[model samples]
Target chain A: MRVFQILTTVSYGDAVSNDCLALFELLKTSGYETYVYAENIGKQAERMGVKPYARLQKLRDDDIILYHLSTGTELNERIKALNGRKFIIYHNTTPPDVFVPYSGKLARLCSCGLDETRSLKGTFEGGFCDSDFNRQQLISYGYECPLKVRPILIPFEDYKKDPDAETLEQMGGDTKENDHKIKNVLFVGRIAPNKCQEDLISLLYAYRKMYSDPIRLILAGNPSGLEKYMAKLKVFAGELGLEDIVFTGQISFAKILAYYRSADAFVSMSEHEGFCVPLVEAMFFDVPILAYSSTAVPETLGGSGIIFDSKDPSHAARCLHEILNNKELRDLIISEQKERLKFFGYGNVSEIFMKQFKEFTGQ
Target chain B: MSTAREMLSDILLSSGAANVDVPVSFDDISVCGASSADGYLESLEREFSDRAKVIPQYRDLKEKLGGALFGFYINHSVEQQNEINARFLDVLREFKANNDEIVRLSNRLKELESRMDDNGGIR
Candidate 1:
């Protein structure tokens, strides 16, 4: 029997899209006729066999439809009408209020998304979400189906590509050996208010005050729809006299790899996430992580990295200092993070998916 | 306070950086293990952070048409958020004052301990 996954859009390098792409390839490898249909496909993804939503016709009743639920889309309404055993991969919707100030479209989309999630109560047969946090949200939304928690399938093999030469040269090859005075702390995410880039600047301000060594904050991700938020952050950083930051907006994978390779810490001040892929990425790259305990971050990290409960910049700055300056602690954290990274191991995750998938399909 | 984590906690506590009020209910949620956080590398990452730029014209025709509604509520929402932030900053101002005082007192105590250590006068 054939299987299909449908979503609003599959943008390149997005976490949800990445998971969908990996799962699509995995299903294909498993010898099932697999396809991905999205409302909009990224520029180069057409070559990868992702077809437009209009191409999704003639579905057999026995076929399976995996709908990715992360945003508001007409697909959420239309998927129920599709002829198949429909299941949803709940990526958890971002609350509308967070985006209301920046993008009314995003806000409206999220608002409609949440309402639609509730409206979709009896439509799905059985499905999975990426985190226990997401699972809980689903359960609370009154989903009665047999639900399970599956971590995102990070194609870790793809991460082994050679780091970008320019990025490596720019980072001076070995930051530790080359520059004793400067430390590189990096956060990879969009320049949205919810990601809280301003807090990174605040923490940098506090870190400089506490430590003699200066730091540069690297924020790697596209601004996407939040130009105003990014502008406000620049003004705040400037007012604080906070200089030396790199906001690499929507860079190539190789460039991102280089940042991960050269990074001392993978820091995220983001207040919301369904499953943070970068946390897994940082673990794979052996960079210690420091993240705010927001939404699914703690659940996603499990018992791996250092979790600071407060957003107080001073406390975060202190944690940064301890992780960077204390060899024993830093080493232990990295080692533990390596241990946690196995939780999202491709083999482990796929095995779990295949098991649940078998049970769900009753094959 | 003997476990590695306990020792780490002790160092942080002794230095007063562990003053963050972690709610008791949040313990089971796993916020303070070896596995959580994001850091700022003071100056080292500053150069990278300074070069932030957003690529333009990424909007498709649909997105451009939909863009008219992008920030439709920005005036009201931004104002509301600013007001809320103003209140938070007011409270934070007092919080910072107390934190600064605590830092000052902690430093003084440390200075006394150091003098005692140098003089061989502590028990």
Candidate 2:
């Protein structure tokens, strides 16, 4: 099958780009021809010997256009013009708050949620969410889209394992000599207000106050035009005398993987997400997670990681204490997470996506 | 051409205006300047007759041509807006092309003008 994967950009850190690249690799391996169209192909693709086109001209009758949402303009008109089947993969939540303004007041009054109103705006042939919870939320908001039309819970593939000894040594830490005393917590995502970096700083402060021992907190992500926010967070950390925090600005994916491997726990206090890929990546690395209970976090975590009501820092600190103190519980959760990691493997997700595409095209 | 008293009374009645004594005459309206009493009456009668003849046709034309013209203007505006946006893009493209050509043309024009000045002022 010929598939055209449309994305906004070909950046390594973007979730959509990473997922599209993984899918492209998987489809090629499985004997399917995949073409990628993006606005700007980044250096990573050039290094990997992959060329992405920017225009939509080479599509054929045998080809199917797979568009990621919010990437292109006149999407519905273009899809209608296409000779073959067209499908939209909604990576973001439906009835997006962003659309509420364009819909006008009558739509707001008539609709239950933003998703329902957006579906009424006549944008897509079919839509999909990453989880059943998101699907149900759409339905409750008056979306008439079918359950089969919803997105499959495609998990991320686990990267090759690195031994803790190798990772610790690379980071200049001797885990054996120190008796594994390092409690390294890693947060790998864009540093923005929506990612709740401020709240994460607050939780770190509470954690410091509650625990006498110093723990290493590594914030490994781009500031993403939130330099002032990052500055404020650093100043706050300084004022609180929390000197163990490290802000590694925009490292490569390999470095991120290394941090995931060496870290004792993964922490994210994001306010919202369509899906948290790093949480699954953390699971693959077998690092115990502590995340805020919001949006897709709890659904993605699913009893694998520690969930805290991030509104209360005391509660988060308490959860952290429990995870730090109880090795047996932590080990059990990590084992369960490893077992569940199979579901999000690239092969499984690729098959699921292909099956959905086939069904959408009635092939 | 009706008397001012009669015109005001008609306007008041048409507009549902209230609170005035009835039975005023053309003599009372002479103070407000009409050509004459008979001329005022004749003018009002001619006006009423002309209106009776024109109102139906005016209503029909408004219903048909007014609506059609309004729709045409709305569609025209939309098309014009799109054309404006396209023209803006075209201007940007044109500005980017052949910067040296524009400079060369200006220099040539300046040279021609200098030659013309040296000639009998109208070569």
Candidate 3:
């Protein structure tokens, strides 16, 4: 049987694109004809052998189409019209307000994506969601089809080793004073309003003001088209007279692994997360996690990390201070995260996917 | 003492008071008196009316309008403009709060000028 995957935009370093490519590999290994399609294909998409979505045509009854749904699009209507078996992989749409101050176009697209997601009540026979939070959202949207939870696919082994000498040097690892260690606080995600980099900066400000020990905060992520917001963050940091803060705008995988490996603790003040892949990555890297108790973060962490409910900068600062200073507490948190990471290992996740695929296809 | 223009600029930049040349004309006092919320709302209505008598009925007009008219320009303009607008709003609010005192001072100056005139230009 032929299996096809589709997405709105297949860009390099995107979580959905990574998931589709992994799924495509699995499908190909299983001896099924698989093709990937998207509206706009990025460079990585080309390497992954993705085709333009325009080639989607009338499919045979036995053929199956899998759509990686995140944002809103008119493609849902087209998917509903196709004569093949349809399946959806629901990636949660970001709340529109996150984009309001940055881009009205993005905000509208998110709002419309939510609307389109809601409108696709029975467009698919069944679907997979990345998290229970996203699954519940689909159910609330009146999706009555059978749905299963499949966590995002990440190459955990890529972060298993120590960062290369060049990457460590670039991130200021070697220049640090050997006499006294500087605690590294890291956050890895897109630099955007919803990710709450501003709030993280505020927490960093409070941390520096409250403590004498030197600390370096490394924010590693693509600016994600929020360059203005990123600039404002830098200015705000400057206004607060903050030092030792770095914004590594869109680094390579080696750099990402380096940030995680070198971090004393991973702190995330992001308000919105649809199964935050970075949280799991931090866990894989054995860095203790500190995240805002908002959205799917707590659920994704599954009681492994420190969850701060307050938005108060000082309160967040206090939590980070306590986590870094208390070696016993930090070790305990790291141990729990390692165990939690095991649940999302590729071996187990792939098994779950295969079971669902077999059940759906009845082959 | 700094000049009025320098003071205004200082106020625009930082919070501590500076010598600003606030024009306290008699007409300025009168203009403040006439600029109430009622008049402001009416002017807004007239402005909207002048733009287009018929408002298009759409479910997502804000998004549509932002995309069509301001999408490309406003995205670049928002960061700098937002800062200037925030500072301007702070100054405007301060001016509104001291309006009565400003009017009273203007009238007192006017009375002094009239008395001086009545005394045949103060001999």
Give the proportion of true interface contacts each model preserves, from 0 to 1. 0.04, 0.00, 0.00
Question: Regarding TM-score, does 1 or 2 come out ahead?
Answer: 1
List where candidate 2 sits over 4 angstroms from the true fold. Answer: A46-53, A70-83, A93-123, A133-158, A161-178, B1-123
The DockQ ranking, best first, is 1, 3, 2
Q: Which lDDT values do the candidates have, in the order given? A: 0.77, 0.58, 0.73
lDDT tens digits, residue span A213-289, model 3: 77788888886445545656665666566645788988887777777667777899888888999899888877778
Of models 1 and 2, which has the larger lDDT?
1
**Model 1 Cα lDDT, one tens digit per residue, B45-103:** 23223322212221233445654566445445555655665665556557656866987
Model 2, C-alpha of B104: deviation from truth (Å): 48
TM-score between model 3 and native: 0.72
Please report, as a residue range, the 10-residue window in candidate 2 chain A with the lowest summed lDDT.
Answer: A98-107
- Greater-TM-score candidate between 1 and 3: 1
lDDT for B3 in candidate 1 is 31
- Listed in order, each prediction's TM-score against the native is 0.77, 0.63, 0.72
Q: What TM-scores result for chain A when each predicted structure is judged separately against the true chain A?
A: 0.97, 0.80, 0.93
Error of 1 at A208 (Å): 0.8
Per model, state how many residue pairs clash: 34, 5, 2
What is the TM-score of each candidate's chain B when compared with the real chain B?
0.32, 0.23, 0.27
Q: List the residue pairs that clash in candidate 3.
A: A72-A113, B4-B21
